[model samples]
Target: MQVIATAGHVDHGKSSLVTALTGMQPDRWEEERRRGLTIDLGFAWTTLPGGRTVAVVDVPGHERFVGNMLAGVGSVPAALVVVAADDGWSAQTAEHVAVLDALGVRDALLVVTKSDLADPAPVLADVRARLAETSLGDVPGVAASSRTGDGVPAVAAALEELLAGLPAPDTTAPVRLWVDRTFTIRGAGTVVTGTLAAGTVRTGDRLALAGRDVVVRGLQSLGQPVEAARATARVALNLRGVAVEDISRGDALLTPDAFRSTGELDVVLVHPAQRLPAELVVHVGSATVAARVRPLDDATVRLRLGGPLPLRVGDRLLLRDPGTRTVHGADVADVDPPELRRRGAARVRAADLTAGWDADADLARRQVVLRSEFVAMGWPVPSGATEVGRWLLAPGLADELAARVPAVVARYRQLRPLEPGPPTAVLRSALELPDAELVAGLVRPPLALRDGRVVATDSGLPEPVQRAVTGVLARLAVEPFAAPDTEALAAAGLGPRELAAAVRDGQLVRIADGVVLAPGVEDRARRALAAVPQPFTLSQARQAWGTSRRVAVPLAEWLDARGVTERLPDATRRLR
Candidate 1:
């Protein structure tokens, strides 16, 4: 089945023409039938000459209901553009044509209604000429009067030809059903109706609505219950987990996590000659929201939406002045635009967008974005973007981040000279990276991770700490076995923290708490013990090194712990 919308001026017989072709009344409301005018959208369908079915979305032609008209035609691929033979063309007709043209709706059949009341040739010729100026250029024309059923068969034939020419709908795409009507059924809870433009909706399928998931309890198409409905077909869904009041017109039933809802978007004007207003109402699909426009350039503008919509690049939007009949078309260039915070950011951004909406350009601006989010926004992963697990890094972004690492590490070291380079967390923040894995990946030569902290392998201790270490090592050089006492160590500016830094720098060896010796002192002590007998007492070992018990006990214990010496049951130690 295929869906199409009807467009024309008021009293141009748009609804009447639909009825004549479908053999059913398009107007549903009692007031509309009584007043002989369409105030809201009406629906009707019929099978054409073959088994192919066509559904008609009959929109109001009156100027007051232009919003309604826009909603009806937003998702339809083709349109039945109606014009009365007697009226030729009217103000509403022109607006509707502009809307179709702005939306890039190309497949249409121009119908000249009320042929019995006036000559259809002039109106047909005039409507065709006007359509030539828009995207719907030179569509086929048919003169038909719903009153007398004149030329009705030719209208059906023309519609079949139009439907045959339309591109096939993508059934495997993500579902985004724009709700045009919502209400409660007698027994089925909340039921919402819409045109399924892409993907397929099956009964019991879970769909996203307003950030919550709702189950499809039942599904129907063309008043008949169905298990599933594919694209280009109108469907009504019985939903669970939501009340009727919660759902409204213009809300979408979506494939969960398949789309990104964004409030700020950048768009390029479809018709640059039509100047935009500072504020307007934006219509996309069946949704309408007020927006504030900031001009990026004469050809582009930024739209700040009152509410976020599930939007992406290449989506078509209709900008309407709420107080006037002016309507402008725009193509969304960026759904997640950067903030214009700098003095001339707007100008710079305008220049960047001049290349149009390319995936690489967006990736270049964002630097790094989650692959899931990039896909959700309907953006293809650009070639040459670096993939770091779940994230896609812009070209050269990793190198740029890596280049900043040394400076950040230097600043950190300058502030806290006694410590290693910096913690992984610090590097992550300085590089503005989202994950620690990225920080690890950016570590270059001479920069390495030591005990989860980033460090420069070739770096040395701070000058003050180095001076203290040099003083301690110099004293140890003369007295190889004499470890400095607490007071002497403090006098040389060797506190516990500084001593730890010296030990990490391989300048000092810490044997026990507060007992530190020069590097390779353990080997020196082992050789010194070789001069004694195979097994010696602690006092004898103390004599061998000519150091006091305070140095001998810890050093002997350190050797035993390292398996360099063995202790017997009698408390005598012997070098291994």
Candidate 2:
């Protein structure tokens, strides 16, 4: 599928030309229908003679609605840049091209609309000259009059040919569909419709909605329901249980764990769009987000984005000034995280950060990100931050450390019932690591430390309950294979939260109602039953072992069925 945005000056006949070619009006709202101008954003698509369809997004051309135009045009891989043949390039002409170039839309065709009203030569010549100054210098041009319908068909054919010649979009990349419109249906629940700019969406898929998750209940291709839609296709999604207000234009629906959010950004600072010395807005995907610019010494600065966008390395953002409304630059570097930071100059730069932590491997990467932001502000990247480098850790190790911390603390609580956790040094010794490196592996910016122990901010368990859970395990270890009654747990001097936490962590196994055993008791019972001569009966076994029937009956019966013992049809039992 191929998608294109129509970008141009206001009232330059962009909407009329779209209607002439598609036979479907781009305007949908009643006000727009009456106003006869493309207000907000209108969408339509067309099928060429070879039977290939191309989706067209009509962006608002007025100066005031430039932001709307930006949101509409931001994701399109190509564009139809409209200029008025009679009036030549309007105020927005330069701005539109600026945004397109900034967004890296090199594959575009210029449309000189309203051709019948005036002489075409002078206007076409001016557009030709303007095109030379843009990344669209080699872009094709076509003239059309919505009124006379003189060159509309030819324009369509030209667009289809251009689309046919372009390379296919990379669909295998992680999907990020920035929503431009969201609404609700009576039976369908919430429906979000948009052009999928960079990825694919399929039915029954779970998509992370910025901060939460929503399931894809259904989908539509053009107006027909379908299974999947890839990049450069218009899509409407029926999402199950997600409310309409949970998303809006510029919200990215992406795969969880695939996109990371950061307030900091790295960007290349150059353009055929404009000579930008002033700060500008950065629009990426469908989000009309803005970031202020200060030139870094090495052509990179940390950007504080307006929203939690799913950006990664090599992701391109369209830059424009919300105030002056011009596209400033094209293509930015992705430092490490996707975060928003200072608007102008910083004390740290990427160069300085690399200089400091390059040897420690773990600390080196973190210091680069932290110190870069600091240097951009022109502030000293603090010694405290540098000290943090001593504790900086690899992400995989940190994750492993995070996963083990709760259980570790739980074990600590067990071994020292009075002292919930031993010193960090003891923990290091237990894990067989030097105290310093272990602390470093479990401590750092992304990880946290409290009460002298490292904890994962993302790990949901709290400390007090973790201690209680530990206490339960300690008590259980002392009295293995014994059934601990509910009241007995209450009697163990364990809090309700601690008791619950113990169960949650599998510290004690609840075998039946009010019949809980120590963690490994069930396995021990099964093993012992396997060695028994016969399940003649619990009473018979008690007599043989000289122990109590209370200990033998359930254990023998459980083991008898576990293939540890065989029960005869007469209800007697023997080891298998």
Candidate 3:
């Protein structure tokens, strides 16, 4: 499906032309029909000769309602520029052409109406010459008379040929449907109509409207009920969770999270003759808001919007001075722009925008950037770009992290030698790195990961602590399970700190609190318990170990916990 809006001066027979082609009245209100002028937007659709359906949005061409006109055509991809044979070109016609040019609308059809009343050759020649200078240059033109229906078939044929060349809408892109009309039906609840510019909308899909989610209870394309609707079609959505009063003409139904609303933008102006005024009315999509402009250079400026708009890069906005009635065009360069803090910051930013993304330069300015955002801006990652998960960092940043790890681990060991080295999470926080993968990649060579902690490969106990560990192990070897208590171990300089270090180094195994054993003692105990009967008593197990109850009891319980034995109801133990 295709949508084409009418652009011309008032009383130029735009509505009449639509009514003649589609056989349906474009005027909806009684006041508009009585006044013989289209005060608000009107809609009508027709089947072309090639069986292709096209919808027409008839916009009021008066100067006072240019805002309404912009709302109707801001999202429409193609248009039919209407001019009258008798009037030739007028002020509103020129304004409309300027708006289309500002919107970057290149696909159009020039329709000269009232051809039966006046010879359209001169008017067609004049309109063609004028449009040749603007963005709608060298477009196809047709002479039609809506009253007598002469040459109307030629207009239809021209539209069919134009629609043939139009590209299919991108369904993969995010949906941004600008609401041009909203109302309530008797059984359908709230119905909002607009051109589905991109993406697809289905019956159960949820969309964001005015920061709130609303379910699509139903959908219609060109007045036919449908379960889903695709782009470039005139869509009427039956919204479930909103009221008629909650939505207005300018509110948009967008794919949630895919778009962001902002009140500020960085843009590249189109043929900016002079510095823009301090205040201007900016039109984007279907919404218009007053904004303040700050010039960055001859062709760049920063605009602060009066309200938030879901804008994206490459979107063309029409800037109009409400006071002076001047129109200018601009293309959005950046949505989330950086703040200019110091003097000459704007110039530097302008240079960045103009130079595009240079990995070296951007890394020097912005140390890190989210990989998703970087790619969305159409930047190519330089060769050897350092990426840590979703974060893209500078090469220098990785080198810096690698360089800081050793010192960090050394300080942590000096502070707490008994404990394992600093945890991966702690190291990440201390270095202010954003990702754990970055820390993991940086811990290399002389650094290694032990358990969950990062440590130097040579990290160990001091000379005195090492001697104490060796002495403690020798004593445990004599009586493996009959290990020394906390007091006896502390007396031998193997205190809690030294014991913990030994356990971490695999020199000792801690069976229970204050109970340390040599590494091979648990295996010997398991072997001894296996030789007993199927179910044996605790006294028998203690006798087998040849130790006192204090040491024997904990060791037996530790074996039970390790699944080597199970305690019976009568206080006997059995091998599993």
Candidate 4:
């Protein structure tokens, strides 16, 4: 599927051309049909000769409604720059062309509408010369008359050709549906319609809207129900958990946590007639909001938006002055930018943006940067770059962490030998690292992460705890199944803290509360039980081990828990 928006001056027959080609009315509102002008976005689609479906977004061509026009074509990959042969070129025509060029729209069809009124050859030549200087310089053109239906087939062929040459939409990219229309159906719930710019949205998928999650109750492509909708197609989503009044045009439905909405952006202005005005209307995606511009250099500026917008690096935007009616094209260099707090900071930032990421900077100073963002900014990761999940650490940061973390863990163990080594959270905080994974990555050989705590590979009980454990082990070795009481063990130096440390360090194993045994003591008991018959009673097991019932009961239960022995229904025991 492909979506193409119409651009031209008012009364230039953009809607007429779309209607004639699609055999469906482009205008939906009665007022637009009565006024014979498009006041908002209109939708139409048709099947090409190759049986490929193409959606047409008919936008208002009047300069007054250029905001609405921008909202329509902001995310559409292809466009039809409409120009009437009778009225050659106009101010709105130049404005629309400037927007398309600024947006970096390369796939387009330059159509000369109303060909029956005058010779299209002159108009085509002028339009071609104008486009030659813009981003759509190499785009093809077609002369068509929507009223008489002449050259309409040629227009369809041009659309098919334009789509064929364009690259396929990335269905795996994060979904960012810029809402152009929002309303509610009588039987259904809230419905938001927009061009699926990228990624695939399926029914029942949860989408982020205004910082809240909304499930896609249903999905439609070109007015027909569908299980899922892919990019470059017109999509209408029946949303749940949101009301029609809560959502409006310019609001977006996006993949959760995949994008960040920011009020400040660092951009590279392509062609500014002069220094931008203090305040301008910034248009990107399907949004138009007032912004304050701060010039960084000759071709770069920082725009502070009136509201937050979900944007990314490499997105193209247009800055139009409402007072002077001037437009400037801008390419986003950074979405989450640092604050310019000192004198000459803007100049420093401008240089940094141009030079790209600094390889020598500390990871703590650089913060977390996604690998995808680095690729979008055209900066490859420096050699030996450390990555945690999808984020890349600054160069040399990993080595620095590797050098310091083991020492930190050793110091922590020295202070609290009775407890496990510092937990993952504590390690992250101690190092001032952003994520726990970085701490985990730093834990190497002599240091290991276990049960959410970082501990030395050869971790053992302290001297006092080891002395206590040694006494307990000797006592248990004399009588394997006969465990000492807590009071007796404490008297022998194995107090509560030392006993816990011994267990944690693998010097001892606790079979039950207040009952401790040396490591592998259960195995020795299991071997003695195997010497008995296939099935034996409690008295027989007690006699075989030469221990009383008190020692045999707990040992039997512990062995049962370990699956070393199984108790039968008749009160008999056997090896499992």
Model 2: runs farther than 4 Å from truth?
Answer: 271-280, 290-295, 330-332, 335-348, 352-576
For every candidate in turn, the CA RMSD to the true structure comes to 7.2, 11.7, 3.1, 4.0
The 0-to-1 C-alpha lDDT of every candidate, in the order given, reads 0.90, 0.67, 0.85, 0.85
Give the residue spans of candidate 4 off by over 4 A. Answer: 272-274, 357-392, 417-420, 435-437, 459-476, 481-495, 511-515, 527-576
The candidate 4 region of ten consecutive residues with least summed lDDT is 356-365
Q: Write the per-residue lDDT of candidate 4 for residues 295-345, one digit (tens) a residue.
A: 988778898999998887777888888877777888777776788999999
Q: Sorted by TM-score, highest first, which candidate order results?
A: 3, 4, 1, 2
Which residue pairs in model 3 clash with each other? none
Error of 4 at 469 (Å): 4.5
What tens digits encode model 3's per-residue C-alpha lDDT throughout 1-576? 899899999989999999998998988999999998888999999998889899999999999989989988898989899999989899999999999988888889999999988999999999999999888788899999999999899999999998887778898777889998999999889999999988999999999998999999999998899998888889999999999999998889988776768889888887765667888999876788999989888778899999998877777899998776678888887777889999999998878777763545555555677766655443456565688777778667778778888888888888987776889888889888776656776787778987988976776777788888788788777767677888888887887778888898787898888888889886788788778876888788887777778788888899889888888888888888
Model 3, TM vs. native: 0.90
Better of 2 and 3 by lDDT: 3
Q: lDDT for model 4, on a 0 to 1 scale? A: 0.85
Compared with the true structure, what per-residue lDDT tens digits does model 1 show for residues 477-504? 9998899998888888989999888887
Give TM per candidate: 0.76, 0.63, 0.90, 0.85
Comparing 1 and 3 by TM-score, which wins?
3
- What are the per-model numbers of colliding residue pairs? 0, 28, 0, 0
In angstroms, the error of model 4 at 467 is 5.5
